[model samples]
Target: MKIQAKSLVDTVAERLEEAIIGGELAPGERVFEQVLAADYGISRGPLREAIRRLEGRRLLERTANKGVRVVDLSPERLEELLQVRESLEGMAARLAAGQIGDDEVGELRKLLETHQETSLEKGYYQQSGDFDFHFRIVQASGNGFLISLLTEDLYDLLRLYRYKSSTMVGRAEQALAEHHAIVDALAAHDPDAAEAAMRTHISNARTHARMALERAEAEAASTAEG
Candidate 1:
């Protein structure tokens, strides 16, 4: 019974994060604990625990009035985060190039093939599987601190922005090509090339994200005026 309840908390937390990433839960939206708990068909006790976990992840923040809101970093703040991401992920690629084993490189190749097939089926963008590519490389880096910082500290938040950017026209194919380049660099064990390729990929993603956000804001403004 205790284990089941714990499982329920984990399930709830996972779904909530998915909702946020999928844009079902808008950035800065207020969360209604009772309603959300009811929606999940769970008691408030478990739901509160789940929410607390997300809050700890820096995804949710609590207010003085017991209100919970998604963390909505402004454009400038998001840019700052992306800049840091650019550097860290580049470093990860460089390290991975230096140390990644043949088996792991082969596994990454398999992942890309899987991703390509997935893309063909879905017009080239699968939201659920998108984060897997970078994650595998970061793990291959073998740097515990970089792994912890990127995966634990910044993964989901960065995913949020990337999700927004990924839907842009032509971005899917472009990103896939970029992924291929990074993988090629890693396969060749060229640290300089790997770092350069990864940095370029991240930089391009930041540009796409900025454009997507601006379009969304403009659409919202138009709707408001109408």
Candidate 2:
């Protein structure tokens, strides 16, 4: 593939990744190269490249005997991911507190304001904006490596969970309040406070995820029993 051709693969990877994260391709869905090629108006070659990239990213898995499919994140994996997210986000908030100044802090505050406003309008729009609010905090840490690795990708994975979480009874308002606390800590330039706020925010999100998973499992069990 030429340099330009390689870039097309990269673009495919991103779009497909977003689609998976956004739940367009639900967990365990098989990837068909032909369908994807038709949808994206690309050739099989580029679609294959995209699949390979997703597999590398751990977003898709290829069974030894079967073809590639979207990863079905078990509850255990969700718990593990939540633990890691808490620690990483805490560090990000701490670093961002000192590394970023008032201007950037102000930007975050504005984002939160918009998030709250938009959230009241509709569930889906709120879900999308909430991601931007949290991601901007990660970017404000000024850690290029962490930002590059976690920014869109991690949040993409989290987007579905975030949507689910935010839609939970009273969680949308509660999450907005958590954002307020983190913003205050950042504005104060208090690293410890910022870290604590972020830790709490992620912890709450983890709890929400756990509850959601449990509810889903229970529903499935109830259906089976019926």
Candidate 3:
């Protein structure tokens, strides 16, 4: 019984974490224990436990007396985070290319193929596939330490911007082309090419996201005054 309770808490935490990442739970939104407990059909005990778990993950932050809110990302903060992520992920790509086996490379190619099938979808699921591709690359680097360094929260911050940029004309197709270049470099076992390809891919993604956020903010300001 105790174990099942713990499991429930974990389950709740996972779902809530995804919700936060996928933007269903926006940043700065207060988390109400009573509301979520009732919605998930769980008791407050497990829900509180779940909240604490997410808090530990850095997905949620607590205020002095104001309870918890989803962690917020300012434009500068998000850009800084992207820069750090690109450096880490670029190194991981280089290491992966140096040591990855043919089978692993083939598996990554397969992920790219799957993503290509829906590349034109230009929706949440398509973007989800893109995330999966990048995640598989990082995990395949065979570095547990590197894998631990990047977590879902960091990915979430990027994903929010990615999702918005996906709606832009030609962005999804451009992103897919970059993915193909990366996979090709990795398959050829060209560490230099692989690292360069991966770095360029992240650079382009950051550019698109920054532009999208800037445009959105500008439009919002215009609408507010008009």
Candidate that would win on lDDT: 1
Model 2 over residues 1-226: C-alpha lDDT tens digits? 1123458988888788777766588677898888888788778897798898878767888998779999875788888777877888899899999978888888887877777767744452333433477778888889987776666556555665665555466677778888899999999999999999999988888787678677767876899999
TM-score of each: 0.91, 0.79, 0.82
- Better TM-score candidate (1, 2): 1
Error of 1 at 206 (Å): 0.1
Per-candidate count of clashing residue pairs (backbone under 3 Å): 0, 0, 0
Off by over 4 Å in 3: 1-6, 119-131, 151-169, 215-226
Evaluate model 1: give its lDDT.
Answer: 0.84
Our tally of clashes for model 3 stands at 0
The deviation in Å at residue 205 for candidate 1 is 0.3
RMSD (CA, Å), each prediction? 3.2, 4.6, 4.1
Candidates by TM-score, descending order: 1, 3, 2
Candidate 1: residue 83 Cα off by (Å): 0.4
Per-residue error (Å), model 2, residue 206: 0.3
